[model samples]
Target chain A: MDGEQQYIKNVDADAELVDRARAGDLAAFGELVRRYESRVYRTARHILGNDEDAEDVLQDAMLKAFQHLDSFQGQSKFYTWLVRIAVNESLMKLRKRKTSRTVSLDENIETDEEPIVREIAVWDDNPEQRYSQGEIREILDTAVASLKPIFRTVFILRDVEELSTEETAEALGLSVAAVKSRLLRARLQLREKLTRAFKRKGDQILGYV
Target chain B: MVTCKDFLRELGDYLDESVDPQVREELSKHINECPNCWVVLNTTQKTIQVYKGMDPEPLPEGVHDRLIGALEKKIKSQA
Candidate 1:
């Protein structure tokens, strides 16, 4: 693995940095930012669907994490704590969007009562490998961008960030049932969306997926 | 034999293996016997796998510098 890969993937490595950071080591805190800034920025970027708002959230979330360093209990991994802050900040940004096309945080939970089961399109066994990384990134980003904020956030937290259901709930102020409901739909929803994007035929458009 | 609705109801938990053993077994059996549900389960799993495997994109140019510069300025002022 590359050095940058090790820097972020080693969650355990953040502990000593956090200790130094708490002791007024600004450089250590900067190191912590180096480790997580991409992740935190991407979480915001994915949630907000634009760079301008995401940049604002990244700065705000990092600044907030720095100012509140003393409150970090260390019971959980430091990365998750950073993520929780970034997620909350992203959600706040979502709420404040002035566009006519805004999804309320509670917008789509009614699907929880009776989930939709469609005629799913079976994808190629390894659709991801068929595309270059940049192509896959664009495909997935467009697919995720199509989801409503309600389902999108849960899917991002649980699936993307790999947070536990309970932690996802706590991060979003949602119940476990709510998180699961949204995540299921998000998965199924993305499956359907990506099926179209991934279709080798490229000539058909239908709801089967 | 678990009904498709029953299988769908327990799917998220089934994927997480949080369902009761009996329910999980039923869901597993149902998927084995059912093509449509199997497709749903398989594609859904793959969808998540695709996303989880995506690497984090680097921040836009100057974003890191701008953020760190602003923070450093703030800290310096407070000191």
Candidate 2:
């Protein structure tokens, strides 16, 4: 099916599930949880930075979602609503611990008047070819972890969860301009991390040559 | 013509297809002729692509079962 058809199908399915769940069909609720648990878990994990805390947020968010199923008006997709809960729950945990790292979007990248050419290097090997899947994931996870929570949350929502700019902004309670700014910074930071990794790998290859 | 600075500033919007047609055309033109900006744009695009392709870490089976188990208990209590 085309994208629109698939979206409609998913909406239908979610509506059915939500209706069943609202009727106190625990199995139906479980099905909803099954569909979104991984995504919720990952978002929590990225936000909280640990599996134990993520697990706590996961259960708390899901339980809260279950308890408040009546509040879900179907105006938004169920998953989007659930993600907002998960993000809020994770942030709550961060607040409790007083460990939320906020990065300023106003921070400017140092740009030279003239474009610098020497810093750019043509990567010889595809990153996928240069690293194993596990290694790449580790590198990516570490890189994402390095981002400030604001940028990281934006990155995870927009890039990792594949939410749209509007959805991301709604989830984080930010303006579209703020989402775009943070997302650009997140992407640029991640690119710098990956580029450094690839440049190091390229240097190693040159040594062997 | 869009300068490298102008192109970099709009790079995200260009990739997102949110920029106006005229701005996109200018950015595209600049990237085509400027290798430095091109590499930056290319690598950044690749980075996003790779990140999007990376699999989300699956919820552990134990955690999954435990969550459902806990939720079931909560539902039972409410009932």
Candidate 3:
């Protein structure tokens, strides 16, 4: 295989391992888990917004994938199939833990958007630049997080994961047109947030810190 | 033959290699003539680049063991 085709094969190779695992091959199953554990957990974490919930979602999704592996025909990549499972698991977890979420759609409260999406660490900087950067990251994160779930998912799958629209559409069961539309909205939203974030951070650093 | 909006609309498709050759050729010609279109192209390119640069968060600690354990338990029960 050429480099690109070889890379694709590396991903497709999971289908073979999955097939073996379905035949009761424990080692094959383990290999599959090792290959995707981090990515699955990370996707869950981002969608669910907490490590505890992310872990639960990952466990649920992995178990489900193992159980349903017999039905996988390799039409979609293993990772894509796995991600769909994880997304469902995370959303289900969110529904289950609905009461615990700090965010409520009904409340028009003026919550700070930045800190909600990203954790802020103490800055070692002379206190000014550090605060500024953290503030920017916060706004960027919040702006990203505020996107409607569908739009946000498209952004995550396409931009962050570098999946093409067709792949994203296949994974999410969306049309290619839907994926493109949502992706454009997501990007425009992020750009607006980033612009506002940097400007505000710049002003704050010069004035307050 | 390509305008700024047309270029932006086709840009993603072009990057994904889903655009037809005619549109691609038109976009190339437009890029050569239009500074505004060039800026949009540059910004969109950088946006994708920055996105790719962000490090994907790793799996939560012990995710492998947890998944494997869960899978084993579920599969065994089914069997």
Which number leads on lDDT? 1
* Full ranking by TM-score: 2, 1, 3
lDDT per residue (tens digit) for residues B1-79 in model 3: 5666676667667655678998888898987887545544544454455556666556656766676777778878877
Per-model CA lDDT versus the true structure:
0.82, 0.81, 0.66
For every model in order, what is the iRMS? 2.9, 5.8, 9.6
| Model 2 C-alpha RMSD to native | 4.6
After TM-score superposition, what is the CA distance of residue B50 in candidate 1 from its true location, in Å? 0.8
Clashing pairs in 1: none
In the order shown, what is each candidate's alpha-carbon RMSD?
3.8, 4.6, 8.1
- In candidate 3, what are the lDDT values of residues A69-168, reduced to their tens digit? 8888788888888888887777667667776753322224222121111211212223235456455445545766787666677788888776777888
- lDDT at B27, model 1: 85
lDDT of 1 at A152: 89
Task: Sort the candidates on DockQ, descending order.
Answer: 1, 2, 3
For A118-151, candidate 1 gives per-residue lDDT tens digits of 5466676566568877888888999999998888
